[model samples]
Target: MSKMDIYRRSQFFISPPAILKVIEVLILVTAMILFLVDNKCSGDLAFVTIFVLPCVVVALATLISYISAVFVLVGRRNPLTTPTWVKGDVWFNIVSLVVMLVGSILTLTNEGCANNSLTVASIALGFISVILFAISGAVTYLVLVRHQQEVKEAQRAQLNTRRVTMSELA
Candidate 1:
């Protein structure tokens, strides 16, 4: 069987969340790389460093989260049942989203670019990453909501079952 089928059979590779996380990772990495290249190409260390630092931090956090997710999924571990992992994932994304948004805004307004092409490319990539993060955040929120709904439904069903058992016993 193909790798895709293996992932599906593992039962932990929920595609929506994984896809969103992967997209976030790629965009953040791309933006970070472009920013670094821009700095090197333009010889503007200070300006580039200021922007690159936050991007680096966010990108690293995203990478860690992505790796953790992949490990869990591949190992057939349910993130939902793993509170710590789930918490880390949630906070990482939240922090990454906030940092990326702020960094994008600052990058767009940043001046002193000897190479406008690199600057523009980095800034555009940052903006795109921010948008993708927002989309990921929305999707995560929806997934959580759906999970909660499912939990509630299951609990209600259990309660109904207990009620019927007690009524029959009575």
Candidate 2:
């Protein structure tokens, strides 16, 4: 691949859902750091094991799926993650919102979080992650809807550039 191909591939990471995924993963890391603090303070990983583990597992899985899907399907005209278009990311964000919210609430309600400054900061970041997940879901959904409409209109058009040009397009 040329430099331009590499640049286009990298550009995919800056899209809305990609940015949100990066932020969500970072927030989850912050939570893990707080868990480390809790481990150091209490000689145990009780709260972290209970509240943070699930979030970490789920978020990592979601991120992995997204990146893998894009890598596997970027070249084709796949609706999910083409070189020039992205769709199907909404589902991951929507699912993440629910799981992260549960984890955040569990962390917030624990007395350990209230007492530990690090825990408080961690949960706060987790909450922000929940909000970001919601926004990401909304944005991806809008992009999907617009893509669907464009596909429909293209069907109606008598001359479609994509259909006419059969080059190895992406």
Q: Whole-model Cα lDDT per candidate?
A: 0.66, 0.66
The reply for model 2, stretches above 4 Å from the true place, is 1-11, 38-46, 78-88, 159-170
TM-score of each: 0.74, 0.71
Q: What lDDT tens digits, residue by residue, belong to model 2 across residues 77-131?
A: 3333342334446666767788878877876777646677777777778788889
lDDT by residue for model 1 over 52-167, one digit each (tens)? 77778877777777777667766766554455665666666677777777766665666555346776787777777777676665655555556667678989999999999999
Reference-based lDDT, residue 158, model 1 = 100
RMSD of each: 4.6, 7.4
Ten residues in a row with the worst lDDT in model 1?
1-10
